[model samples]
Target: MAIVSEALTVEELYYNYPDGTAALRGLSFKLMPGESVALAGPNGSGKSTLLLHLNGLLRPSRGRIAVGGKPLDAAHQAFARRYVGLVFQNPEDQLFMPTVGEDVAFGPQNLGLAGEKLRERVRSVLDQVGLEPARFLERQSFNLSIGEKKRVALAGVLAMEPEVLVLDEPSAGLDPRSRRRLIRLLKDLPQTQLVATHDLDLALEICSRTLIVEQGRLVAEGPSEQILSDRVLLETHGLELPLCLMGRPDR
Candidate 1:
């Protein structure tokens, strides 16, 4: 039987900013193929800083990271970027191209896709993200609503066909309907996912496992239902029980 490699791994990771502020401290975790995991923490708990290291956007000050079992070093960083798709909390950081189509095409275009192949890639991912390609293709990206822009940003990442998806605060700044739509879309995607979010309900709905980080270190981990239902555990980490569990007798 062929062995399956882990989709992502981090070992003894540490990162400190130029100002000497420590962002990550000996943090470590792993994601197997097709696993959906949630990273829960309070503000300044280093979730964003840790995520930037996944694709080599921010190199770790110490320790190791691997994408699809390949070391994320100077040589493999490019591969890591292509293998791991990261969606920022803010759509503005991602949607910078003139039109929606151009923004979505940026990654694959850089990968050497052109003409019909590139067009199809853009069209396919837009459809994946629930956007109508014909209507969105030529529209100026700056004109889309918050929900549309977030989906467009996700489409841009999806066009790369990455093996893993890393999203930071994916549900932030969304209306209830838009949030539901985004949740549905994420549930349908097949990539291994590491979602950093404060939305416990979304975490329970989408992620099978949950890891809690505190003061730049992993403090707890377990099945989503088991971990998310612990009121004391949630409160200790500056989180609350999932809304779905709020009224339960045990909650």
Candidate 2:
């Protein structure tokens, strides 16, 4: 097979749980470098399941995934993990370290960074996510507000310096202000981002393209403006027009 030259590629991907539940079925797509795309689908559409497959967290029952042009398998799992940093839907799931600095530094530290290099990575990523390292570092990770925890969780992923960032339900539980902050932060990031979300507005705001998945299949893929504004197509797959698109003539 000719190698795919995209930042990320998924070809005819399929996955099944031990109980025989098929989470993904023949899904294929390509994500280019520095491109922001959204995986928009309703519950049980295999959005999270698909993200896990990207970095080899959950093995595919059948099919293939490649990161930075290399096939993802046990031999390349390490590279895939580092190349595609996944921020889970819940901030608590990713922030287990005692202090904010410790949690932020965890990934790079595992990769052998220490002392000033380690501290710098932690600080830079925190700042990258709009958190002030000096004031927030020594603070307890568990004590942070929901918004702060979300930013800290993202900082940890950014610290890995992944070529592609895959986030699941990034705006799931945020207040309007916090969600707005996250939207702005995500828009400014430079990595190839695949955000699996129910927030079509976020997709419409930050993504160039949108992939609509249903029953683990790629039902539709197109430019965000075209795909997201199509009220019929979105509703057909258990989604709605982006909030901003509502009340328009098309609606």
Candidate 3:
């Protein structure tokens, strides 16, 4: 089958941290609409750095990033933000309002939605994340469990109705049950997902394609099954094959 073009495209991307540490070098990829992909790699492998560039949090030190065929620019930054909603690795970083509903409402409100429409959007997104609208809406953000907070953060992003969802280490630090819940929720969502994670199991379950990076450069790109099944290649880049794939009967 021929590959469809992309809803978001990154070409020849290069970026360096303020301390002069290069994070991404000549990275290029395209995310087709409704496609799920995992960006897997080790620490300092530039996963977070790449996510930052997707929504214009960090402009490229070199090369270009385009959303829906329009190059990223000052005027188009707002449009890009609306199109690509980034859910940070830490829920605290993304959710700041006193109440869960307020936090979820922040993004839509900023987009100038108000009154009934804003309430409907907030309630709808919270429900979508499996958080009961009435029960969670008035609750304080700090009182919720880590998993609940993560879902709330996602609800906040979903409220924006983004075409592309960028997630950074979404399953990190969750208990088994919470992790399972998150995986199920992720699988159910209809939006295109660009997930940055070290969880190969989750990646295998939810993503069709995998991009492996090491030390600021993309080392592997292919179908998730092929990339994740190659134990030697994964080990070379300081990664591991998913346990289920390690002792497969066919292998």
Candidate 4:
């Protein structure tokens, strides 16, 4: 087998809140370019904390985190932000601009792209996410539906053209059709994706690898099939195995 190059790497990462309550405890993992990996865990399992560290939003209290082979710190934070595009679990948190176009253009504009190039980037991303550029460009974010808002949020991150896309619960509270559409869009994106979600079926459908986190610690890491099929392990970690794979003699 060929070795994949690392897009994100965490080395013994540990993080704590203001009150000194640790949220992440010595967690370590590597994300390769063009790879889609799912992060599965219950609430307060450090999933969000780990995601924040990928883009330098929250520095590790101990150990180190590197994005695209560079250390995540003040010196490399700007570079890390450009390389890692994070789509928040709530679209409301990500969409703050008066207009959808402006929100999508925010990242690229900050990066110094202007004129026709910036417009092209914004339009391209919006279209890629299944939003009609002409229709959404002038629309206010607050007026859009939940699904549209999610797409716009994704477009904003896509406009940045980051090497890695870190998504936190991308499929939360959406209708079945919307969920499927989002999953399809994610599957089609040509970027490395680290999806932190409670949707095991989504993970099994879209991710090649899986990482199980529990109580601020990583308990298991392996191919999605093996990890998802391990009923005992899943139950112990407060997770459930996908039904289709629950009882198959061949598996």
Candidate 5:
């Protein structure tokens, strides 16, 4: 089989839950290296399902997914993990270690990194997330604020140094300041990113391309400004224009 050069690709992806609920319906998209794309949709629109598949957390009943040119399957699970990192919508689900540094060190530790190298890895990612290693390393996860916890969670995934970052509702529970900081941080990172978010503003600010999903299928795919400006199309898929862009026809 020929290798796909794209950073990520999905072909006719279909998935159904054990309870008979269809989560994804023929979803297909490709992300080139260093490209950032937004996967926007309403709740239960398969955005999370798609992110899970990118990192091999969930398997499709039908169809295929490739990460960094490698096909994802049971045999390539570890390879997929190394190539793709997924951050959950909820920080609590991803942050389990008692201290902030411990959580960030988990992935590299699993990969056999230890001693000073592991500490440096953890510190670098924490700094990248805007959490200074000096202060946050020893802090307990349960004691951190929601915004801080979210950053800690992100640091964990960033520490893995994946080629692709797949985030599910990254801005879901953040304050305006925290959210803006996150946007800036993500923009500075050079990895290929697929963000599944309802924050149209974030999508507009970060993603070059946007894909809208509704009822387990893609409804629209185009440039961010073009897709978000289509009021009728957004409304049909349970999305609204960003507040700043509202009342502006030229947007």
Candidate 6:
């Protein structure tokens, strides 16, 4: 039998800013293929910093990161992005194109796809995000609501057809209905997922495994149900248990 290659691997990663402020301290973890994992932590717990490393947006000051068993290096960064797609928490940061279709087409266009291929790619990703091609294609991105913008931003990344999807606080600033729809969409995707979020309920619903970080260190890592149920653990890391799980006996 063949062994399953890890989708992502980070070993003893350490990152420090120019001011000498350490953001990641010896952080290490592994994510398997087709797995959905949660990165749960308070603000400034290195969640965002760690995510930057996943797609080579930020280089590690020390240690190593491998995507599909290949080590991440300056030359290989572009290649890595082909397999690892990252979406920021704020849709506004990603949507600068005049039209929604243009934004979704950006990544593939950069990869040398054009004309009929590019149009089809844009149409397909819009459909994937629950946006009709004809209606949303020509729509001005800036005029859309926050929920619509988020979906459009996601469609842009999804068009890249990555093997692993890394999302930072995906459920942030979303309405209940939008949040539920986002959750359903994420659950349906076949790509390996690593989501950084403070929303315990979102983590519980979408991720099977949970890794908690605090003060740039991994505080806990385990099954989502096991980790989230421990009130003391959550409080220790400046987090609160989800209200829905608050009175449940299992929790």
Best by lDDT: 1
Candidate with maximal TM-score: 1
* Candidate 1 C-alpha error for residue 100, in Å: 0.9
Each model's lDDT comes to 0.93, 0.91, 0.90, 0.90, 0.91, 0.91
Candidate 1 residue-wise lDDT at 43? 94
TM-score of candidate 5 on Cα atoms, chains taken together: 0.94
- Who is ahead in TM-score, 2 or 3? 2
> Cα lDDT for residue 221, model 4?
94
TM-scores for every candidate against the unseen true structure: 0.95, 0.93, 0.93, 0.92, 0.94, 0.94
Expressed as tens digits, the lDDT of each residue in 1-251 for candidate 5 is 96548999999999999999999999999999999999999999999888888988989989999887789988889999899989998888899999998999999999889999999999998887779899999999998998899889999999988999999888888888778889999999999999999999999999999999987899899999899888889998899997778988764
Clashing pairs in 5: none
The residue pairs found clashing in candidate 6 are: none
lDDT of 4 by residue, 73-192 (tens): 899988999999998888998899999999999889999999999999999988777788999999999999987898899889989889999999988877787788888988988899
**Cα-based lDDT at residue 95, candidate 6:** 94
- Model 6 spans with C-alpha error above 4 angstroms: 249-251
Query: Per-residue lDDT tens digits of candidate 6, residues 1-251?
Result: 99998999999999998999898999899999999999998888899899989889899999999998889898788888998999888889889999998899999999899999899998988887778999999999999998788889989999989999999888887788778878998999999999999889999998999999987888899999889888999998899997778987765
lDDT of 1 by residue, 33-142 (tens): 99999999999999999998999999899999989989999999789999999998889988999999999999999999999999999999998777899899999999
Model 2 scores a C-alpha lDDT of 0.91
Global fold similarity of model 1 (TM-score): 0.95
The model with the greater TM-score, 2 or 5, is 5
lDDT at residue 207 of model 6 (Cα atoms): 96
How many clashes in each structure?
0, 0, 0, 0, 0, 0
Model 1 worst lDDT window (10 residues): 173-182
